[model samples]
Target: MDTYHKFAAFADLDVERFKHFQEEREALSTLKAVEIDTDADTRLTALTADVKAFKTANDNDIKQLKQQINASTKTYQRLSPFYEQRIALLDQSEAVIVQDDDLYDEITRTKTTQLNADRLDDWRNRTMVLHHQLNKAHEQAKLKEEAERAREKALIRRRVALQQRRQQASLKRQRINETKAYRDRFDNLVVRVRNRVDTLDFKVIDAPIEVINAAEAVAAQAFIFTTLKHTDSFTTLQKSLRDTDAKKIATQVQKAATSLWQQLERLPDNQDKVEVLTKINERFDHVPAITIDGATLTQTVTEHLQKTKNAIQAHEQAQTRRYSSPRPF
Candidate 1:
């Protein structure tokens, strides 16, 4: 009867152990059924730590239960049936734990894959944005380079144009200087001719033949120098000088001829006067026959001298007749 009571107590203890194991298994299933937020990394990491701790604790509990069952089997050989039943329960519990472990591993693998895919997508998006920025920078740099080249070209063109303008201005100044020099030289020549013309001494009428010839040469030169040819190209100043010189020369010739004619008229009515008049008439041939007021200067002087000679000859003949005839006194 004591042995029977001891077996019954052992059975009751086995039943309690089995009930505790069942409770542990049901707790494990409950833990698995609770859904974890996959998007939250902190929650998933905490849940995985908790699952690992629970698995370690369950493994310890299972090992302890097995040790107790072995002790009980050694002490109570008569409780073989109970020991066998507990062994089967332990096996079943082990199987369930293994299945839960496999399911947790699969969940871990799926979460890892999802996290890796999210990381790859993020990397690709960043790469695309970086590439776009690089392209934009490259295009902007190209445009800037082109603008710099165009500015350089425009500056070079402006410099060339400025140089050309300077060269043209220099040429124009040189031409103006040359033209001014030519005009100065031409004016000097005209002034020299005028000075030579002014040197003529037309006041001296009874001068020597050499002096008369010198005067006549001077007059001829003045006439030729002052005359304007049709082929001559003259400026306004040169044309004015020529006309003035010509008028002056004509006036001088007229004055000299008139002075000689007046000198002949003042002479006494004698052969000396007639000889002087003939000498004067001969001198007149060498004078320039310049015309003034439609009358030639030398020709008019000759006519006046001829009239004086004729009067002188008539007076001399009257004096000779008076000397040959009886004295009228």
Candidate 2:
């Protein structure tokens, strides 16, 4: 009963205010007419012509004003959804309400207004402001990404230079080693990989030198064709040799890496997938070193694998906590 009385009081107050607003609005129209006729000393014919011209201009202005308002409303509606989606993508929950929907809604709510020109212009300007802000934010983000890419490229060049220098010092010594020795090393690395998988832990591991060498052996070993069936064959064992088909081998390795990644993606959330993906991604990070594209591949795979591993670890941690927590009373 108290709730009903309160609602009734609110309704009565709204009715009274609406009646008063109507009376004031009508008075404003009368005031406008009185202003137009205030200069009675002027010639009647000229005054009548002036009033007709004013009405013509007002009608034209109202038509253009309404068109602007409608166009602005449409633009705001179209971009509002995109803005919301972008905010969601960026995970910015707080800024989800950019230019509130209510702003646009208020502009579109009424068909009639005493100050239509002022209201329409204000609404249009508000939408333009929001549009400008979105464009500025997008451009700034693009610039930031470009700058990051430039920095990454510089870092990659340094890494490639360091790798090349290391390879040059070892090239002569490596060439003098017996063919049997190279084959033995390659087989040992493959065995190491099998061992790693058999005793796998779910935690992420660094890209070990043995892992990197094994990946290189997959593409560079002379006996790789005999050792691993259904694998690609390269002409030369030494990657530095001109006869080696580095590009073709790189493509094959890339395909294999992508296949492994797809398998990882399809796996259900489990420790087995995490362990498998960690080894696969380590191989991915170092495999392309026998070719010119190694630096690019390493950088790309490093960023991707780090993010993926971090997310998986976080989920695992969360699950552990959830299961281990004490129950409430």
Q: Report each candidate's C-alpha RMSD, comma-separated, in the order given.
A: 27.2, 41.4
Q: List the residue pairs that clash in candidate 2.
A: none
lDDT of 1: 0.55
List candidate 2 stretches off by more than 4 Å. Answer: 1-102, 110-115, 175-329
Go through the candidates in order and give each one's C-alpha lDDT.
0.55, 0.52
Model 1 regions more than 4 Å off? 1-233, 269-287, 327-329
- Give the least accurate 10-residue stretch of model 1, judged by summed lDDT: 104-113
Q: What is the lDDT of residue 59 in candidate 1?
A: 76
In model 1, the clashing pairs are none
> What digit string (tens of lDDT, one per residue) describes model 2 on residues 47-96?
45655675676576557666766776776676666444433422432242
| Top TM-score model | 1
Q: 140 in model 2: Cα distance from truth in Å?
A: 1.0
